[model samples]
Target: MSTRHAVRDDLDSRPWTGPTRRYDILKEGAIALAIVAVLTFGLSALFSSPDEPALTFKGWSQSAPDNMYATMVAEMSGSSETAGYGPPYNVNSDGLSIGPLALQKWFGVTHPIDAAQDFVIAPLQSQQQPDAVTAAVSQWTSASADQRTAWATAYEDALNDPAGANGDATKVPAGDYGPVPTLAAAVVAMASSGAYDGALASAGGHFFNTDNTKQTMLMGDGSYMDDLATAGNLQGNTWGMVNETGSWPGQQWLATYSFWYQLPMFNNEDPNNTVATVLTDNADAIIFAIMFVVILLFVFLPFIPGLRSIPRWIPIQRLVWRQYYREYGKR
Candidate 1:
């Protein structure tokens, strides 16, 4: 007989003569269950998720009223990031693309946010305001688009000038801002009183008012959210993806996803570099594609030819069965 056939026949005829221990599967399962339960409850209580209070427009306005005012003006001027975000919002500019795919644009404007009206005008219109504030809103809505842009542009420039008021809304240099300042001031007042949060949330006229898109977008336009994120060390550059707020362990499973962002091409820190810019622009799509391929490879690893043979070639199993090998000699 060939060596392989002889070995298989010998193994088939062989009888075991080794020490054995009694195993009660039911007892073993119960012990395992008790241990797992204790650990689950103990660890969960010890490392519960952070319970920070939800951020509010009222809080933001109270903390940084001047920043809020500038954000409102930016929205009205159609200069805010959301205003030109393009696709899934508006088409003012084309969003990130992968090669010639224009993947973001293909999705189209699903949410359809008119930054000026939705973030600033709509919320204000929903709430009761002074006659001057109402008139300012009317003036804004009635003015030509160019007129509104010009007014907002002039006000934003003045608001941003550090040597001037340095973003202090009340002290901005005098200009032909028309009624924009009045409208902005009204929104600030709303935010300070906490009524602005309700106004934006209930803008859809729903009693439940669960959707917070408009409120979040408005807050995102200001610096307050970014400030909070930086303070918590939750910025993407800080490896925030796997980090929970405070000292708690975050989602470690996202390590693979966050790992790519640490690389230069994906970081977007150097915007002037052509390659970095291209990669950053398409980072989302590219990362997703890479992850998909990685997942496929992982799932098919057992079926791959050379890869599947690695376990056998490495022969780590010999270590596991060392006692048997010592007794019977290497098979």
Candidate 2:
């Protein structure tokens, strides 16, 4: 009896040892990698690539039907980038003085694009008799602003009249228009000859074969951008630039900023659109700063006082080790 009692006491006091299996770390790692590979392959097959293909200037000029705006875009691609962009296009180095106050203006002269020389003259020079185009470019450049304006205005009016397809613009009443028509003709010829891309490339040190800048300028010139803006409900009416591409999620985080644009004060105000844009820009900066601070706080949360104590306050420890608690309680 004494021996049996002693054996029973030893069994009770001894540490509980159940499984004694060796863990192969290499085998576990290999198995994990295999599972990840299979999962990755399945996901890849399920989801395809996301690519937003854009049309180029050459493509649009070839395909787009003759419209008032389309012709305008084609014609204006030379000069429009001047009035359209604030600086770099115009060589306004002081434009970045506004900083975050005018975030758009802050990154000044980063891209030094001379619209007329790059878009118009360069493209024309790409073709045969480049010297002739160069001389014409020189004449246009030397002309007075009033002369250029007169020429541009007259040409713009000429475009308004119903015209032929991909041909010479109808004759303008011969006046002090100077070499305007010739320059305009040069542009048209460049477009017609499909050397427009060559001209644009010439401006970018003849390196960029892509027609992105040319196409963008073209789109803005014609009512293309206006049409797109209208279609996308980005017009000032439908709450300043909400994502209008049919049922797709918008800038979800910017919903509040968008909501401000819908207000009567913003909607009805004459310069509300500009005001809203500025406000949104400022608000975005503030929101970004707040988010950054929050992220930093989260990163160092373990060292934070109140946050570190949250685990104890919630007492999740008791639930996780409930069996150990029961055993301790029984003791």
Winner by lDDT: 1
Candidate 1 vs. true structure, TM-score: 0.87
Q: List the residue pairs that clash in candidate 2.
A: 123-199
Instruction: Tell me the spans in candidate 2 whose CA falls farther than 4 Å from its real position.
Output: 1-32, 51-53, 65-82, 92-108, 129-139, 153-189, 202-277, 280-331
lDDT of 2 by residue, 1-331 (tens): 6998898768778996643458899999999999999998997787643333554455445554344223543343333534455554455333322224555455566555555456555666556645666676777778876766676666655554445223234544444545555665566556656666556655556564654555565556655456756776766447534564555545556554566555554344455477555444344444445556766777999789998889979988888879866866622
211-251 per-residue lDDT for model 1 (tens digits): 77667777788899989988987877677888888788888
Task: Look at candidate 1 and give me any clashing residue pairs.
Answer: none
The clash numbers for all candidates, in the given order, read 0, 1
Q: Indicate the residue-level lDDT of 8 in model 2.
A: 71
Worst 10 residues of 1 by lDDT: 12-21
- Residue 202 local lDDT, model 1: 81
